[model samples]
Target: MKKMLLIFSFIIFVFNLLTAQEKEKAQPTPANKVLSKYTKEFAVSLLKGVDDSMYPKIFKAKMSMETIRKGRNPIKFVYEVYSKGSTKSLMEIVFPARDKGKKILLLDNNLWMYVPDVSRPIRLSRNQSFMGSTFSNEDVSDSTWEDDYDPEITDEKGDKILLTLKAKRRDVAYKQIDMWVNKETKVPIEGVYYGLSDKPIKKIYFFNVKEIAGLLRPLDMRMADLLEEGAYTDVKLLELKELESVPDYKFDITQLGR
Candidate 1:
């Protein structure tokens, strides 16, 4: 009877050891490896669905801006953004031609302040901030993903993959960006922007993930300013339409005056 008890104890010990080994083997190490490959795929999916027809074409945006310091109703504005490539961009705010009107034109690397009372376009620097918001003309005028950045995978985990992106042109607003892509969904979960100082300038959090045009994408983004303790920016995508056959001439800087 004592010998049988000893045998039973040994069998239990061996079973526990086998269980622990299996658990260790099941750790998500392989999932991390698969995530790295999906990171590149996510980047391609985002770029491919961005409606190329919008490129070299004009699109209308109904936007509102409110001064944070003053408690006032948000100022409403109607504007058109046109883009062709990295070198060219044009923005024209329409005057009371219809519903909302305040006409201003931004062309090429310069801004043209258009006041109906003034006769000609006033040249302004691209460095000027837009409506006291974090975005500048350089940020607004940036073309698609291809023109702005070149991304490479830096690190990966079970459900997270890190990407490091470098600005392709000197005129780009940010120098580098570190993006985190979700493994299962293949979408960007977060992005960190670095400035010329090689320090983190902003961190963008993506939420409300959804599948659009057969691709998973973020519907809302919140940006935290790393320089300022409590300052942040929120951008909500109201709509995303895949357009076709946007004309090239519409995006030209020369079209701004017309």
Candidate 2:
């Protein structure tokens, strides 16, 4: 009986030793491997630049939105977009003559749409679809990605840096995003937004970089819906001006269509 007890104790000890070895193998081996020198702070600063390279802080932009889907004619709309800081924005549709004068306001993560004849402003969520396009309301809204995501530099290619952004909170539109940025220009090259299950939900590419508002920025953005093949949206910036500031009342829900 004593020998059997001794044998059982030996087996338990060996099992625990093997378990510990497995756990050690699972942990990152930074000491043994040459790690990337880029720190979190550096990653954050680059991301902030990438955000500004897309749009200016206080500006009014004229853009066109076109949505293409399989077995359907492409739908297009033109708009004037007003933005202030990182939390407030207003988009007014100006084309498709019949749909003109419609406005959408984004304050923080909340959205409100005002139609020409509607009595009240319709409340919307930033996570929902924006005007039937593949881009979400948050995508159209003025938001600081650096605040919502914690960025990590994963790779550096010839002229681009690849970053893996993890959502800082659960309520965000994407759980993770793999973004590539042009190192010299600070303009985002492309990104793939992933869901909570790590499934790629959308892919976005930036093009047509030019000097706008004293900064080099991408004038055209394309968002492809990963779930729906051949379904995508293109938002092209027609006009942009960086202002000192935008009027406060322009973002008021009650002042949507005014």
Candidate 3:
């Protein structure tokens, strides 16, 4: 009887494991929003270019983020980031001793935080502030915008493409975004984020463009809180190394804190 029970438990564990892996492979929800300008082929091509330029398929990097407020001293955090494809990423705090050993993971479109003392990881909301920074949790994770938004070409300025993205589903962190993309590079330049009410809530500016992995990529970005003046978080990618591949088990949520 004990052997049968043990086998049953093993089966359950395998089922749960497969379920989670399948969830990570889920496709993007289709957009119901109106797209006035983008053609099917062109839109797909543009979004692909943007995603590719955003980050490499597999990489490990060191980064720093500084949050500056109106009157308070700037708060800084350093992290070692690892990403696999567009779906899995893990970041570990390596600086500001107090936050050391804390980790953040993104998997299957969900965000989680793992602390040294916490028995289990805690699920986090996508729209919530990330460690009290101006950047939202979604801003830190959710790198695959193409999976969550439908694109429309609204306008163009010299050397820039004004692309507007409408959320494909209601659960996304932002309802709409008007982005400025480099015409030649297809990399994002600047963007304004909006909420469900269509009110502009935040803005992001990407800078420090340099060649990485044979493509020009932004190594630094500033996220501005439109609701509060003089509040912004600057994220800098201090080091990056492209990898041919990363071990899949490294992104497993169950192995996160271990």
Candidate 4:
């Protein structure tokens, strides 16, 4: 009888343990544990603010670029933009000396190729390569960040989050891009760009993070060309200052011809 009682007690204990395990499994994890609070909806809202914060109303920027070609030393091109984004106002950069001295007025989409002998505004397409580099007018056109990219959280793996971005319009360069965002920093660690195919046409790695306007922004970005061997582009953001006020007219393409 005592033996029977012991067996019955052991069975009951096992049954209780199994029930406890089932109950533990049935409990749902907190949403924060399973998914980042920044869902697709939240990312969309955050992106709106992020885009606005990147642009200042009136600002000056200096870009020094090194163009690489096969079997040749890279050529350096230095330029600056004095933009209100209000009018079609731009300044051609004079390099080799004077950090901020020589400035030429560029009033139209036609950028005058200032040669030592000839002086005339040459009509150029936005798609033309700038100084043997992949940078074109489409790359340099003063654009609103809000109009360029939309970040949506699509998936998550462990602590890394995947974000899918759809270009606002076909007039923009990239059709689609996938970003791998850090769960903690809310910043994109890496990005892949897609063209007409499922394969990524370009892979980008961002580093050198610095605080800008209370948010961390990538200071250096390296983009690798998938098609061309040993071809790549590196963009280093120098300074980004927010503008106090900018006229709405700054966004006009007609201003490009001004």
Q: TM-score winner among the candidates?
A: 2
Task: Tell me the tens digit of each residue's lDDT in model 3 across 1-258.
Answer: 999999999999999999999875552332334346557667667777888887888989998999999989999999998888777889899999999989989997889999998899999998899998998888888368888888877677788877778889887889988888987898899998887766778899999899998788999999999989999999998998889988877778788777
| lDDT ranking, best first | 2, 3, 4, 1
TM-scores, all candidates, are 0.60, 0.84, 0.83, 0.60
Give the whole-model CA lDDT for all candidates, comma-separated. Answer: 0.55, 0.86, 0.85, 0.57
The digit string of per-residue lDDT tens for model 2 on 1-258 reads 999999999999999999999977554312222126987788889999998888888999999999999999999999999899888999999998988998988887677889988999988876789888999887887788986898888888898998888889887888888888998888999998887666688999999999988889988999999999999999999999889988899998877757
Q: After superposition, how far is residue 110 of candidate 4 from its true place, in Å?
A: 12
TM-score (C-alpha) between model 1 and the true structure: 0.60
Tens digit per residue, CA lDDT, model 1, 1-258: 999999999999999999999987554312112235446766555433332312223333332332222344433333454444445445555423542323344344455655444566566555455545455555455445455677666677677767667778777677777777675665667877777666677787777877654466666666676777755555554545444434666544344345
Per-residue C-alpha lDDT of model 4 across residues 1-258, encoded as one tens digit per residue: 999999999999999999999977554311122235566677675555443333344766665666554576765656766556433435455575543333333334333333332344355554455556645454455554345667667678887777677677655566667777766666667877765434456677778877775677666666676766766666666666655554534434334233
**Per-residue error at 217 for model 1, in Å?**
2.5
Error of 4 at 129 (Å): 3.5
Residue 148 in candidate 4, Cα distance off native in Å: 3.4
The local distance difference test score of model 4 is 0.57
The collision pairs in model 3 are: none
- Candidate 2 Cα misplacement greater than 4 A, ranges: 1-35
Error of 3 at 165 (Å): 0.5
Error of 1 at 133 (Å): 1.0
TM value for model 4: 0.60
